[model samples]
Target chain A: MRIEHELHARRRSRNVGLGLVLLAFVALIFALTVVKVRQGDLMEAYDHQPRVSLTPLDTPAGAPAEETPAGVPAEEAP
Target chain B: MTDINAYDASPEGEFRDYVALLKPRVMSLVVFTAFVGLWVAPGQVHPFIGFCAVLFIALGGGASGALNMWYDRDIDAVMNRTRSRPIPSGRVQESEALGLGIVLGTISVMMLGLVANWFAAGFLAFTIFFYAVVYTVWLKRSTPQNIVIGGAAGAFPPMIGWACATGGIGIESILMFMLIFVWTPPHFWALALFMKEDYHRAGVPMLTVTHGRRSTRRHILAYAVALAPFAIGLGLTSIGGPLYMAVSVVLNVAFLRGCWQIFRRSEDQAIADDYAVEKRVFRLSLYYLFLHFLALLVQSWLGGW
Candidate 1:
């Protein structure tokens, strides 16, 4: 059906490989950003870690897990 | 190979020839070793930074390949093993390879510095220079010890990777470097023994070409013997545990036995089986590096598990 198979196979593969590498780099940045956003944008997260949470875990009635940030209101910290 | 200028007949270069310039197969090994180095280090690198560092390291490795192709194109045309490569086959222009090498080398190093520590980027820069200039341009045509010294270029990856994460080197990384360094001669020499004519044809002065086959065989055994302590030594380091130690012991014993088989064989014997022992050992050398690294990964993973 196509003589171009013999013609440009090598070129296509090389372009695809480079394209894939570049795409991966871009995708990683986007993914990491999403992870950071999902993790509540802890800018210092790398010093710790930021990860995506899939299902929200249920909290016990009227109890909060997180300690309030220094001088923050309870509702905002929650 | 047709003419050294085959690409001229084809006009604009095909994409694959550009890939050939990067030498992807070699890049695979470099990237993996560097990944292991980065992984086994003490602290965590941001996943994004880690990914960028490894990608740039791979690009740096590819850049070295381009420069090597640019410099060695003439000899590559003569060697049967290399005659079909892009530069030698005229599928890629010499200037293109050189340009790609310089651009990629510069970008990779600079980006690495921006993303990781300067120490890792600096190490990567030195590695590209060592491979492209020190090993390929200077030593390869000059002496039998070419790969021996040139092997250091390949050996630097893990250290660079460790530095990428830890911003420093340690005994563990040094041992990883030594494992590859000690193993290189025998690996290349075994390939040289079988591809003896290729080196001879290309005037590349590989150990087999400089020394006779007997000497080459002796060198392979000697290197394999020397490699035992280093290989076993690595298993005793922070990276090693019972599982790694066991794998190391088994691998070293099998490797030594393989070398002994090659050592005992005569030229007549090698010819009888088409250098089966040499070929077997060559293939084993690939697995040998791989399994050693795999063992480290296993140790790290299972220990954490």
Candidate 2:
């Protein structure tokens, strides 16, 4: 029968704590990457192609409204 | 074959010892002020990014704290207040503390740059260097004005948080920075007045030890008076509102009154009263800062409504 020494218990706890910290770090980095990628998509999507869903059908000029789903406001008529 | 048990024979620092090296109490204050600064800034930050920014800032603060513990271990060993610290108590090695500080500091700075702006990253790097090299290694032992100058290290977090949101500095952030910077001297001097013996024993040239308690009291009152304009000035900034103004007025009046009382009391009276007033002022200083920041946060929330 093997008896676990008190020192071993302390060491185990230390190892577990360090492991948890590292795991958390990895999770945070992954989450950050996803959020950054999603934001990039939002920024580039509007410029790449016309999004018909974003256009306001009620407007006669076939233009997006002053405050449309795309978040771009209509410019004042010159 | 090598003995696996050999490593266990020698003493090892527990996980909590490593955590203790980070100075969690100071980190909490850093986190709070940085959060408040980020909240009150003009632009909106993504929730995740804001969370990461504050975390990185806290890590930077913690890293500086570790470096401070490593450098000041000698003085810490001698001071009764610090005798039980991780390094002084033999729970953590000096080299380990230094290594942790450098690694954490680097990671925090880099991550902040990637998630926020380079300006905030640079500010965090400067804050770490200022605290670790300028304050801990240089000014702390060399001059009685150590706390006065070193206070800048603690005052930068709110500005950094503001930068994280706006990607640039602003007058509002400057005002917040000044409020903390001016308030630091009196806050620390009050503690120094009551804990003079600790500094005396540790050989640290605190204002109380080098300038005498009388001079230190005078300095506290002087700084307290100087602190009023900055504290009140923050209320007029873009972030301030009626709530903030009222809170600042009351807190400043109470703070000035406390300082005046400390300034008037003789050493004999302080001793007879067991430094009751000095201790009370020190506690009040904590509330004074917390409430000021809290009022700003509430005003920001109210503005949102």
Candidate 3:
């Protein structure tokens, strides 16, 4: 027969609480990541690649765009 | 047979004891104000992200509370009010509290930065530093104006919340911050008025201890006067609507009257009544802040829905 001590019970509760907190932390991080990724296109970040969609209608081809080399292909714009 | 009760002499700390170290009552106020700030801000946060932001902010607040308890454990043991706290009551060790505080503080700040804007995360970090290092370590034991300055720490959560939604600060957030900043002194002084003996016994230099109750009463009145403009002025800002304005006006009137009554009472009268009026005013003061924030939330709901 097992004799369960009060100290052991208290220790078990403490461990359970800590485990729950760690589990919640993992779930929250997962949710945050999913929300951020699902919100927009993966390639939306500026990466020094020129796209015609970002260019002003008035700007001539081969215009010096910030973060983009002059005269990048319009085909790459999405 | 071995004595099963042998371990009872050195009681193992329970999970609740760690929660007690976090000061959940104070955390509730932090959570509410931060929520109102996030909701009233001009931009929208995705619901899930917003939830995470508030959770992290509350964790930050709790971390500061643990650090405060760990630092003030000495005085906490001496004071009637805090003598039963986890550290003081021997349920938790001071070192464990300190470690928990550091770990939680770090996690909350980092997760907030990742889930929200870096600016909001930075604001949370500054608030934790202000409350734990600036208020608890520096201002609390040194001067009569401890709470006056420490009030700024409590005042930062809403700004952090606003930043979470807007990614920046604005006049509306500043006003929300000011509302709590101005309210704290009078609120705490009323507490100090009644808890005077505890402060005296603890040797912490609360205004009531350093300046006497009459002076404390006068300070309360002064802060109430100072508080009205911020409270009323917030109602005039972008977040304020008719409901908020109406509630603010009524609460301010009631608060000013309470302060005036406390201000006018003679020491003899206060003692004769056993500080009943003072206690009543303190109770009113709690409702005063809660309803003000609740009104802000209602105003936002009305405007949105």
The lDDT leader among the candidates is 2
Interface root-mean-square deviation for each candidate? 4.0, 2.6, 1.1
Better of 1 and 3 by lDDT: 3
Query: Among these predicted structures, which one has the highest TM-score?
Result: 3
Model 3, residue B129: what's the lDDT?
98
Identify the superior model by lDDT, candidate 2 or candidate 3.
Answer: 2
Candidate 3, number of clashes: 0
TM-score of 1: 0.81
The DockQ assigned to candidate 1 is: 0.19
lDDT of 2 by residue, B96-145 (tens): 99999999999999999988999999999999999999999999888999
Q: What TM-score, over all chains together, does every model reach?
A: 0.81, 0.88, 0.89
lDDT of model 1, residue B104: 95
DockQ of each: 0.19, 0.35, 0.63
Q: By the lDDT metric, which is better: model 1 or model 2?
A: 2
lDDT (Cα, tens digit) per residue for candidate 1, span B13-62 = 66667877899998999989998888888887777678778888999999
Instruction: Give the best candidate by DockQ.
Output: 3
Flag regions of model 3 displaced more than 4 Å.
A41-78, B1-6
Worst 10 residues of 3 chain B by lDDT: B195-204
List candidate 1 segments past 4 Å from native: A1-78, B1-8
Deviation in Å, model 3, residue B163 alpha carbon: 0.6
Clashing pairs in 2: none
